[model samples]
Target: MHRHFQGLALLAVAAALAILAPVFCAERPAAAGAAPSPDSQSAAPVVIQVDAAHPTGPYSPAWNYFGADEPNYVYSKNGEKLLRELAALSPAPVHVRLHNLLTTGDGAASLKWGSTNAYREDADGNPVYDWTITDRIFDAMLDAGVQPLVEVGFMPEALSTHPEPYRHDFPKGDIFTGWSYPPKDYAKWAALVTAWATHLRDRYGVESLNGWLWEVWNEPDINYWHGTPEEYDRLYDVTAQAIRSVLPNALIGGPDSTGPGTGRAAEFLEQFLEHCLRGKNSATGGTGAPLNFISFHPKGSPTEVDGHVRMGIQRQLAAMDRGMKIVASFPEYKHTPIILGESDPEGCGACSVATNPSDVYRNGPLYGVSVAEAEARTYELARKNGVVLKGSVTWALEFEDQPYFAGFRDLATNGVDKPVLNVFRMLGMLTGEWLPTTSSGGLPLDDILNSGVTRAPDVNAIATRSEHEVDVFVWNYHDDDVQVPPANVHLNVDGLRQGRVRVEQFRMDSDHSNSYRAWLDMGSPAAPTPEQQAQLERAGKLETLGTPQNLKIAGGRLPLTFDLPRQGVELVRISWR
Candidate 1:
């Protein structure tokens, strides 16, 4: 049956090629003084070098690289398939953080506890916490070999400071409301977290729970939290203390505010840290607050340029660098591990408008390119700043159950893996060792620095080494959508004698391993039938470029030249004989 499917798929691809042949054949006049195309004769292979020392550090192996935080929406039937597909891509334990888990009430006091809400109340009107929904979601994650980043968030319904307008309705036509608000009762909020932590300890065991990082609310500096900076500081102090009270060794940290270096995020983090180090806890009156780590959110802007989506990779990195510097400046927080809890290209997760919408980029090669470039840059920023940057979670995963293709900003669409997820799969297969490499005939970093083209032609590449394997990830992307001129990529690999090496490559682009375009080909998820569903499944499959085989190395370097499409990413893994 699988063979039959493969044959049919091949035929389909052949037909597609035939249809696209004309598009590929058509060409405009070459530029003035441009070299003519080579005749049917032999052409020299472009030599690129890969070095062993000047490499970017291994990708964050322990962080939530391909994780999302949409529990309420993902648990539904439609969202489930998308989540499962994302899990299957790199089933190696991932972290899926649940955002807005609490915040059950309509106002600050009316905690309408239910299955959707993480907390519940008894028949007697007393808050009777229920872990049914939380358990189900976590179970699904665990079953998929994914761990929960375990974001302890929004105040429970019974505890929110203002419950009258409890769960805010999804904003109309791309506008979101109700996510930003302060909890009605800080004590109640703290108690709920304590109870939730205690329950997890009882159920998942203290040691098991200890492995997870407990982050507080998301973007407390923005509309996500309505409380004042001082109020949030007090809230963090109480919440941290409560979690510690339940499980003293549990990893607890946050102020998870907006961009930590600028605006409200920086102020919130500074104030929060200062209070944790010095302010007396309103609940316990203790001088030393429970702050296991420091965290903040950094997001990029979404813009539609030249009919394509471009992510602000540099802006986010700049924010991250600034945030790290700010944290490092504090004497008390100098040693704290920093986590960019909700790091991504944009802030609004639920909006999916096609033209310049928050989620538009998720549907194309732009997402894959953005993620690969951002990850590489994040590592670079960390190295230059000399900070222990821990996890940089991609703020999206899969919406459990939504319309087949409602265009949500998630890693998967209707149970099909998007191109972005393929990037994570490539990252996952990488070994955790840094190698050295250089690029020639490419834009110099200084030129890029001065040009302020942070998003375009941002040639960020990284190589990881194991005793026997070398993995190289290269991405060509720019922030603003623009045509990137092809440049010779010269990669030099050193420190090894000529030996047999095998290369396995994976690529994510408009025509490869992209579920969004596939869905569109199947008439979009909005109008899906069983046949379309099957096709969507097939589309989600990550495509391999070539079979692994031995290559005779002339020198220590392997050289090749290929045209990289705009917003394209390539992962090459080489192993020696």
Candidate 2:
């Protein structure tokens, strides 16, 4: 069958599975209920079945995208190291999105703040352009072999209508400063963008620069953009036009609004799409502006409940659902690629546990499993909605000079990788076409959408098939942070041509591939010695379960069983030998 047709069929099967009478309908296995404790073993096994004969559509590496609000960190010592790590995770070039590229400042960085001073006026009120800081930022990305999802935003201080208070102190005070406002002159704004694009094209040939992604601004439905909807749309038009003028084939899109689960955000997204399809172009007098892709942010709501953190996975998924539904409603742009500009456990990446205790999940396997589950379900949601999801940016990066395991929503703290980063590494291992898989312990999509995983742990698996191997990515996740028993997973794979296969498994839990737990075991050091730091770095990387196992296949089926702890993620690779 054609790959596209096969993917549609697979989606139809998934839709049917969502409405099954009994949610856990994969094979005959005992019920895998809530565990007794974090250390206890599971009594019942959750059976997961993977059919490798059928090939779905080609897999898209959506999890490779990452971003941060602090643009200056791109060149910091730790930031550059983290960028290299991110680039090496996958064969595909990672795309990074950043904020405050045009904001005026001295090229300093802090929590939720960064600047390039790319634009400033001369003594006689003429436009002055400086690409030094911006070049350093892009140069770092290129040096690391990553693409830039350039966010053309945060009005320059010289052009902002309200430029007195250009920067803000975040996590302590308001962040909607003067730079968030619209430009005082649209023509000047366009000129600034044009100059920036021209410089990028000149420095790095047009062919190299054309591969970069571009977007107007971030979260216009919220404080990130201080303007009316029409005004923001106009700004997008001008910015898009300016970039294309330098490189006509640039990939650009906009409105990067907040989550659409709320009414106002949904309306904003819908109006923006409608305007893109029909509204007059403010830059060209054309019928509509150029929209190469759609962008939005979907964040969860995690709160400290009863002294433990309870994640709001449903909230984040709902936003994705609503946003895709809106896009699918418009035939003119339904097939356009959609990028989740900032998909995370919650907003406020810079907020630490000292202020927001619920963010403690950032340090352990909870964040890892949460991300695995979210990315897995997103593939299902995209199939159901018949829309293409290009990428989902994990709005996190390294925070320089921070405490070890400080509860900030970041991929790394003080140059040490977190457990969540290993999850991305595991995801990066998955390639080729998707294979149909179902888990007995997984709740239906509607059930998860309605009540989350609070009732029972969500033990699920998504599998893929390549020419040489088949990979199954499994996760045991729960919304509540309470300790639970490990789940016994019986993964059955069919349609392998060989009589035997070599199995390799990678895990991220409290005991493996987790730097936070390692640090805690070391008495939670304030500053680790160089030797300890090396040990922590080793522990932070993805670790396998001992050596690879050679398992025999019976009746064209491979049965592999393992114990997966709650808030844990595992990637099982079966290689043909």
Candidate 3:
């Protein structure tokens, strides 16, 4: 979830810097590590080789997680629809995270803000607890077949150290208000958290919460917490104790700091790990704290250059590289699960293309292809660093009462789906063990780490094989958002059962599975007719390129050829008789 913060200069040492969140500006300036535009030229046909007999490891759905900033949108008409879609996309469990769950408000949601009025105090320094709004949000999630990554967050009004200006008008004024401060009374804060957890247990049963994840606060290394590092540690210790006291088996961990590429954020993460490992716990006077998982956020730094958007894939990857290395440095917690709490192309999902033109990629196939490439590379990074990646939360969801295709960084606009969500639908189809795959035209991981895919397009594929089926996901991605010639792709599969095979292909591009373009072809209507809405709904679904074909496998090998457009994503599924 995006939260506006006060701007501070971040120094980049050795190609590592903190990618700042969105600011209110006409055009965002290019950062130091932003990828330069690549030459527009056609290249060779890529060859992707997949061996179904050899399995590298088990395939984990690390990209199945998603989140947003507005918590009150959980039950909105559009929000509920989108949640059901997300839950249906994956056979595995889908988890949703949100911000402002504990903020003080009257159950309203807006840009970069949400509230449940979960806690407040009455006269004579007494405690008053309310769980009506919170229960509503959780119930909506459970009803939709999704789990909540409960983000214990932003201070309640009565408990804040500076409660005069609890809520601030975002995008027009200072967002780091009193809600960003620490609690004035630690005991009251602990009791509030304990009561909240107890109520949830009593209402939903203990088994339900054992499967969910609980974390304390967001990005405290920045303005998300106005307190010092020690104070944040104290808050986490107390909060973890409160939750554990109620549900001892709940999966809980925290200090979800910003990207550790910057020196300050990296230092904060290291300090927190030290505190959890050896420092005294303020809650129980124990020697160490309970930490089941570690979390951080890594965002790109896209900017408009030469009247087009250029992605900062290297910037985001650099942050992940630094963070994973940090987690691996400690032998005591080297194998703990690590989650990229808010992974995205850039920060500030609430910022639209109208003001910041760099975000124009959100409404097109670029967003989908970019996510595909980023996730594939992240899995590679985790393997390189020898860490178990829990998941990378895509911080985009549906926004209500918005114009169609307004270019907000979201999976859907109003009620219709965007091209990016189709990528997840494709990812959901992948199951079983990962097959050994290699691409001739793919860029080396080190090369992309040093410089992004600026010299050539990354034409790669991730393939998996089940008992009777094989799935291959391919993408043609470039950092610059400009039209170029399509790449010819040759997909080869080996070790398949020798018999008749049914081959099917699904695609997401400009002409297929894109609702934004469909809306534009309908003359960009403010309020579309019923016919147009139905047409767009059909266009939004994942569509196959052509009818499924039955082909004969000769000597257990099959070769297929196709042309993949720039910024296009495709999935191929083959089943043998």
In Å, residue 345's CA in model 1 sits off its true spot by: 1.1
Candidate 3 per-residue lDDT over residues 88-139, each given as its tens digit = 9979999999999999999888888899999987888898888999998999
Off by over 4 Å in 1: 1-48, 53-63, 66-69, 74-92, 105-115, 118-125, 173-185, 306-310, 354-359, 400-406, 441-456, 482-490, 521-525
> Residue 392, candidate 1: how far off, in angstroms?
0.7
Over 4 Å off in model 2, which ranges? 1-43
Q: By the TM-score metric, which is better: model 1 or model 3?
A: 3
lDDT of each: 0.60, 0.83, 0.84
* lDDT of each residue in 1-577, candidate 1, tens digit only: 0000010111232322221110000011212243223220113212345666344455445334444444655555655665565565453556666665664532121111112366656777466777776776666665555567766666665555555555443432211234445666566677788888887788778767766778767666766667787777777777777888988887888877777646656877778878888887777877857787787776665544444444555566667877887787887676788887777777655554432232444666776777776666666566666677777877776554355544455676666667777887777766656765544322333333233243224444667787777777766666654444433344455655587788777777777887777776654547578887778767766777767767777756676555455577777777775
lDDT of 2 by residue, 1-577 (tens): 0000010111232222111100122232332466335544375688898888886768778888999889989899889999999999988889999999999999979878899988999998899999899999999999988999999977999898888777888665667899899999999999999999988998999889877999998888877777999999899989998998889999998778988999989999999998899999999899788898998888787654544667889998988999999999999987799999888878778876556544566888888889998998888788879898999999889787777777788888888899999999999988888888888787778777777767677888888888889999999988877766789999898888757789999999888999888887787789899999998999899999999998887788888889988888999999984
Q: Where does the lowest 10-residue lDDT sum fall in candidate 2?
A: 1-10
Candidate 1 residue 349 C-alpha distance from true site, Å:
1.6
Clash count of each predicted structure: 50, 0, 0
TM-score, model 2 to reference: 0.93
